[model samples]
Target: MSRFTRTQKILMCLIGFFLALGLLFQGMRQASIGDIGYSVLSYLKYGLIDYPLTSIKNFASDFSNLWKVQEENDYLKEQLSMTENYQALYENAQREKRELQELLNMNESLSDFNIISATVIGRDVSYWNDQITLNVGSNDGIQEDMIVVNSQGVVGKVHKVQDSTCIVKLLTCEDKSNKVAVRINFQNEDTGEDAQSEETDSASRAESVEGILESYDADEGAYVVSLLDEQEVEEGMRVVTSGKGGVYPSGLFVGTVKKVESLENQLGQVIYVEPLSNFQYFDYVSVIEVN
Candidate 1:
């Protein structure tokens, strides 16, 4: 009923033929054309609308997982910091325990003597005249002339005392008044034995070779023993306080003989002694109150 060119009419007929063929094929397969159209519409709706909604849900789930992971990382860092702090505290406690044990052992060794424990506070700046300051003073029963000793050996004598602190004149003091009566402990010459002999026999037969500690030589780093008895003194001999003058207690360790020299005209032997007390290292000492 419409006016059209011949070519246009021919194209319209061809389209109608293909559409009829598609409907006929669908009917043979027992599927209606309307059902086919509805299936196509559902596929398009899923691609445009449902698929985007599913993608958004997946994105939200990924974001939540990422946030949880970050929180866990932060928590682990905090725990690591706490662990390091605890480790440092544990090490410090162990060091303190060792120091206390050493102090206790030293106290036990001096159980027979009346002692007042004190800590070294400082040292004299002069190298020639060695001295140390103690934290105890007259308030702690400390007084001048009190003998100061440690686990190793005698340290010095209290020189001056204050209300809370005191100064000790070390055996190395370069003063003649600081002399101490010392004796060399030698093995029994009659038995012809060495230092490995029995304790009782050695003690009974031991001869005390007397000497006077005069002064320290800063250049030689040793104490000079003057007025030594005319005895057979040797190197490596143990020296101790003889308690002759009543200033220092008997049997307090002094040092060991490093060398012995003959005096001119055979007056006496000059013995050089290395002190047992290590002035550079000792931190705690006991002031003996001889009863």
Candidate 2:
């Protein structure tokens, strides 16, 4: 027989490859042939590559939102701080306005003297209640013995005067030289039944009585005024400067009678007068230079 050729051998191998391809397609047809390849490729892409990338993107977005929330909180805190500062400024302005109005009224009543307005610049820490320093001095016509006052009542007198500052010795000092001649005006209305035991049975109806404020009673927070003579005095009596020695002016309100005590060894009664001015609230004052 003729020897088998290379061309026939190649033909037989190709036919065998076709037969295997045909059998694989026949098996796929039974299980949705057209979609199986696509489904496998899609599952591998989404499950391994696409799903992981999507999770990473979502995590980054969540981080960004958290950072934004923190930024918003910081911004709110800054706004609140500014609001508090503005409120403090407004309150200070209102306080200054009220003080100015009160000073205006006081100016009208004390028109007789050369009024020099001043601000409290310094304090005597060693003797806080006894002394304070003012912003006015010799240049401002503030001299020694010049009366110092606020809207409420007498503050003190200029003790030492400098070129632009003066030290005021307060009337509330314990010194014996703090004496002021005072006149007491008894009230016509009843001052309730809780009056001190030293009050007389009869409502004191002397048009007015006179006393000398000699010292300060720290325990009672009152001024101790000694009567010139044994005179009937009661609670609710208005006390004012008598202008006798001319240190303090006439009709300057000093205080009101808080209590009265009769001295057994002395001939006069000790009157306790509550000061008209709040000693704790001193900011501005006026120096009275007798024109």
TM-score of each: 0.60, 0.76
Residue 222 accuracy (lDDT) in model 2? 88
Q: Give the best candidate by lDDT.
A: 2
lDDT of 2 by residue, 1-291 (tens): 757688988898999999999988888786685588789999999999999999999999999999999999999999899899989999887876777678768878999888999988888677877889899889888889988887777877889999999999887888888788989876655466755443574445366887899988878888999887556898888988888857888887888899999879857678999886556566788888865
Worst 10 residues of 2 by lDDT: 196-205
lDDT of 1: 0.81
Backbone steric clashes in candidate 2, count: 0
Model 1 spans with C-alpha error above 4 angstroms: 1-109, 127-129, 188-206
What's each prediction's clash count?
0, 0
Q: RMSD in angstroms, all models?
A: 9.0, 7.6
